[model samples]
Target: MELWFTGTNAGMPIADRNVTSIVLRLAETRGEFWMFDCGEATQHRLLRTPLRITRLEKLFVTHLHGDHVFGIPGLLSSRSSLGATAPLQIYGPSGIRELIDSWMGITETHLGYPLSVCENTEGIVFEDGDYSVRCAKLDHRIECYGYRVEEKPRAGALLVDRLERAGIPPGPLYGQLKSGLDVELKDGRIIRSADVRGPAIPGRIVAVLGDTRPCAGAVRLSERADVLVHEATFGGNLADKAELYGHSTAEQAALTAREAGVSRLLLTHFSSRYGAEDIAELVQEARTLHPNTDAAVELTPYAIARARNES
Candidate 1:
């Protein structure tokens, strides 16, 4: 899996950063991409990367902030013009359907494919054969939410050496054994798949949070995650201002990551006040508190290798 940052600003666009948008790229599947928080000018960010807009399968909105969702209508319209025919599904908190309907209705924009909008509260929001996404309410100005995506565990690989030692040669029987099926040999003996298979590999977990303050929900959503993507709208010196604005600071994000026991911390949603050079100081401050903390940048993509022993 990988994470691509389309935007990483706090409230508005800065000279260096945009707003708040990200993409989750699944390595196991071809042409599959899921998005979180499509902020304004998101399409412009995609232009700089190799990502295909038509491959976007799902969009998860965290709140109703204009900086977070103003690009939706334009992106959706452009997808149709680009000859995309696949259906699109959007999941978010309440009022999402009304907002999209109002915009589409007012503009009289028609889509070539079906669009499914779901406004939900705390529970399993999305699930497919390989991934499952869950959400929880966050402490923000509005009814914001945090998402936890967990990929399903993969099957073990066939131990070719063990099979060869057992007098099994490479052939169609290898395929059957890999599929966890029993194979009957010409000698009237049956070999079970478990006898030559390694242990099943656990999947990786990624937690993404919207605009919110440091609260229990953040820790709960990020518990034991392989990567925790949280918003750090201010520095530690501005804790009061961050709390007043219903946002988190770099120190707060680091504390949450340490408390949640996450393996890595990715901090974004930076205020426009900080320049590119200043981001290093912010990252260093966070790392001082939590050793695994790092800041995100626009158009940067992070590839996460599959867990060890994965099939």
Candidate 2:
């Protein structure tokens, strides 16, 4: 999977950054993308990338801040014009449904595709055979949530050479072996799937959090994640200001990542007060606590690879 940061600035757009929008592009087999926040001019930023509007399958809103949701109406409307016929699902905190309804009602925007908006979200929000997403309350001025996406472990590849050595020709038996099922040959010989299969492929975990002060919920959602996308709305020296504003400093985010034992930390939602040099300093400050920390740059895609099994 890959996370494409369309807008990384907090509060408002700056000369270089837009706001707080991110696109989580799934694998090619999934053929879809999930969005986190749709800040102002998000679609505009998306246009500069190769991602298609039609493939946007879902949106997870963190909070109702203007900078976090002002672009939803326009993005949804544009999706219709761009020929998106597939249904779209949206999950967010309480009042999310009313907020979207008000926007659409006021604009008289009737989308061609069906839209599903889920509100008052908590715990497991989305789940299927392949993946599951969980949300937890965050310590923001307004009600906000952090999401943990856990991909299900995939079955290992079938060992064709091993099967050949066992005098088992490829066919339906190969399919059964790949599914971790024991297969009985026509000659009455049983083959155990485990003996011929490779190691189980571990799933990837990613935690994308909303704007909030560093809290236990953030740590819970981010535990051992492959990548934790947390807001660094202030520098290390502004810890008091970050607390006052219900935000997190880069140092706080790094500490959280280190505590959660995440492989990498992606710091975003930067305040406009920080310039290039200040942002670099924020990253350096974070690195003191968490060596694998990076400040998210707008429109940059960060790849999250699968974790290797300890065994």
Candidate 2's residue-wise lDDT over 1-311, tens digit each?
99999999999999999999998899889989999999999999999988998899999999999999999999999999999999999999888999999999998999999999998457999999988999999999999999999999888888899899999988898998898899888899999999998888989999999999989999999999999999999997888999999999999999999999999999999999999899999999999999999989888788888895633
In order, candidate lDDTs are 0.90, 0.93
**C-alpha TM-score for every candidate:** 0.96, 0.97
lDDT leader: 2
lDDT of 1 at 204: 89
Q: Which digits, one per residue and each the tens of the lDDT, describe model 1 over residues 1-311?
A: 89999999988887778899999988754677999989889988998998988988899999999989998999999888888899999999899999999999999999998899999779898888788999998999998999999988876889999988889999999999988899999999889999888997789899999999999999999998889999988888889999999999898899999999988899999988888777788899899888988898678888776654455
**Largest TM-score belongs to which candidate?**
2
Candidate 2 whole-model C-alpha lDDT, 0 to 1: 0.93
